[model samples]
Target: MIIGCKDDVLPKPASQLRLDYPVAKYASFSNHCPIEFEINEDAVIKEDKNCEFSIHYPKMKATIYLTYKTVNNDIDNLLRDAQNLTYKLHTLKADEIIELPFINKEKRVFGTFYDVTGNAATNSLFYATDSIKHFVTGSVYFYAKPNYDSILPAESYVKNDMQHLMETIKWK
Candidate 1:
């Protein structure tokens, strides 16, 4: 029998993939949608339907969908629907859901931001409302299958952009 050193045939340890993103530069975006906000310059904004929009990040293979709704005295129903979406949409795949409240009294913007962790479809979800006239909900989705560890960098960058959007929303 032959004897070898302990390190002679040791397998290499697994390594994580490295992802780098550019520094974010934001520009104000507005339209006839009755709302406006600042968005990352790298994202492409496309109007969906009604006042809805899709913010696409090609390099990250992700998109942030923004849907606009008129309060019309149904604020309760709107809030409920937005809250339900965060739970129902990612409940199966997400391991944890952390919600943070946001309020900008000066801008009359109030909302909840959800950070979804795990192998979930969305990394971030949020909703802003004037509590009387307007409501806007947004969620970021990746084209690739959800793998939290693999996409953490992209997810983080996108989430920051979403926060900026929520904080700066203005009703027109």
Candidate 2:
């Protein structure tokens, strides 16, 4: 064998890193707020001013912010604001924004779920309201820089959680 002979060098094919998270188990969450819903068992819910809350996911370094408001005569404004946040603010960086309308006649929960794709600030933004009495809006944010590819796993998990929360929301 010739000492100088060597195989041709080639770059290795790119591979994606696999991540796995435990199947989410949810529990009811409520306090004095006009709204009640289920939260991931792995998350910790912290109450804030004016019936607001920050649901923290320690392991994923993500937080879901929920803010409540009385709809009295401002239903239009409230709905517009939520739409602007998802469309105007995030649409700049989002590759596509999919709007999913949610309506639960029994629970009286009507709202829109915004799924923002691409490297935007947040992956999911949602607003649920009773249209006359209670209005609540929420968005999930990751602690890390907005790198969609790197956070896809965690984002998908949290997005699902947010959707569930919106679906189960009840105005109390």
Candidate 3:
């Protein structure tokens, strides 16, 4: 048998993919919809019937779903449903839910924004309502499995887009 001196065994460092996205540029978007908002230049908006929309980000493998509802003296119900979608649905796996309340009286937009940590299906959600005439809710979902660690970079980018969309909403 031959014996040879060898260097101490050391674990190789792990290499991770450096994921990044471009800076967001927004432009006003509306299509026979009751409400309008500034959408990211990168997003592909697919408007559905009843003022609903699916904002697709192919690079991120994600979509921002938007639903618009006409407030028919049922603001309370709409508000509760939107809140539940954020708080109740993701409680199972979310590490924490951070709420950011948004109000733009001039635009008549009032709502809450949620940033969920952990491996929840959705990392961001928001609801904006005039509380008298219009209500809109949006959420983002990645196509891949909900691995927060893996998608954090993309999530961060899309979240900014989401926030921008919310802030620029106008009842039309």
Candidate 4:
């Protein structure tokens, strides 16, 4: 006689659910083209010189990267650059949707979007792309999913999470 049984998959551990806090205040250089923006995760503020932050949503098994630098000192230039990048991304044919303003100039591209705000300050999201990887820079308040090719169907939760993340960004 032969016996057969069904197989079951186990869930991830509680420890696995928590994400590793990004190395704060570490300045690192990258050969890849640079994108800069600012970050405000509650009371925690991090500035990326040339390094970007990558977060993974295990439940979704999706990975997203947030690359930003603080422009607390030069708000005007940051705004100008943000606008310029917005225009640049507009020209690209991305399967993804990005609601931001930018320009597409020769050898450079730029785009910008406003973060969620209350009465005091507003944050911005920016991106610039060339022949290779798209450089994304901006301020994000909450945990965010990266804009990668994998995520599909674009569910409401993901959208809301992204929106909330953008909204929390503070200029200074």
Candidate 5:
């Protein structure tokens, strides 16, 4: 007697779908300084030790930076202040744009995008400027840049990956 297995009988390994997503292209700006990722539609997820994780797409871009300080310290307060500032920024009129108060005093550019509004995407970006303190040791920044011309709509897969990366962030 001879036994033959079906052509598709072989079991496949668990899917590493998470890692399969497109990652941002890492670029170096200054020597021995913070790394910067070029914001683009293909930049879906990023994981790094020295720098924070950031996602950029056609219609929107989000960044989550891990501060050097621990979360138990003043990070929580800083995040709260950032959130409050975001709320106030959103209250401004559509034609008006203002600086977010929580931004570093030294940095002239506080918020990047304006015209805050809601969308159909599963994940929400800090239309203005928003941040959260991680339980582990640092804080995360979330920023969303939407396309006004409707040239390239942000893909759902990229958005989903961004959400996963944000939710999965943990200190080593």
Candidate 6:
């Protein structure tokens, strides 16, 4: 064998690590709270307070927080707070932020969905309101430290679920 053969010493080509998650199954989630939505069947949900919820994905080490509040003529303040929460991540570790507006005129639901890219603490942030009597905000936090590349798979999976939750949300 040749000593230090270039052929053998050449570095292997970079490759992507594959992470496979189970096909998502969703189930409707409802309670006596003023809001209702669908959640990933795999998640563990915990009620935080009156209408707030913590949707936990133990396998993915992430949690989707849902908070509900009465509009009470505080729509402006609520919107500002929600925007600030998303921008806070931008100021820190987010590489890019995309705002997608959501409107369901039939349901009278309107909101903005923030998709954060990079090693941010949260991968998604969103807020929805009926602009009269209901407001809800959601964000996903990973138990593990932010490592965008390493957590991309889990992040994508959970992000889709968050979107589904937002889409199916309805005021009770």
Tell me which residue pairs clash in candidate 5.
71-137
Q: Which stretches of candidate 6 lie over 4 Å from their true place?
A: 1-7, 10-15
**Native-to-model Cα distance after best TM-score fit, residue 126 in candidate 5, in Å:** 6.7
Q: Number of backbone collisions per candidate, in order?
A: 0, 0, 0, 17, 1, 0
Residue range 1-172, candidate 4, lDDT tens digits: 9977967888977562333333333222233334433332312223334556654344444333466544345545655666554444433533333455545554354444433222211122434333233445543322234333323322223334443344333221
Candidate lDDT (C-alpha), each? 0.94, 0.93, 0.94, 0.39, 0.34, 0.92
Per-residue CA lDDT of candidate 3, range 23-128, in tens? 7999999778788899999999998777889999998899999999999999999999999888889999999999999999898899999999999999999999
TM-score, structure 3 vs. true: 0.95
User: 151, model 2: CA deviation in Å?
Assistant: 0.8
Q: What is the number of residue pairs that collide in model 5? A: 1
Better of 5 and 6 by lDDT: 6
TM-score of each: 0.93, 0.94, 0.95, 0.34, 0.35, 0.92
Q: How does candidate 5 fare on TM-score?
A: 0.35
Model 2 Cα lDDT, one tens digit per residue, 11-101: 9999988889999999998798778899999999999798989999999999999999999898999999999888888878999999999
In TM-score terms, which candidate is top? 3
lDDT of 1 by residue, 50-77 (tens): 9989999999999999999998889999
Q: Model 2, residue 125: what's the lDDT?
A: 95
Q: What's the candidate order when arranged by decreasing TM-score? A: 3, 2, 1, 6, 5, 4
> For model 5, what is the error of residue 172's alpha carbon versus the real structure, in angstroms, after optimal superposition?
1.5
Error of 5 at 65 (Å): 6.5
Query: In model 2, where do residues sit more than 4 Å from their true spots?
Result: 1-6
Better of 2 and 6 by lDDT: 2
Question: RMSD to native for every prediction?
Answer: 2.0, 1.7, 1.6, 14.0, 15.2, 2.5
Q: Model 2: which residue pairs collide?
A: none
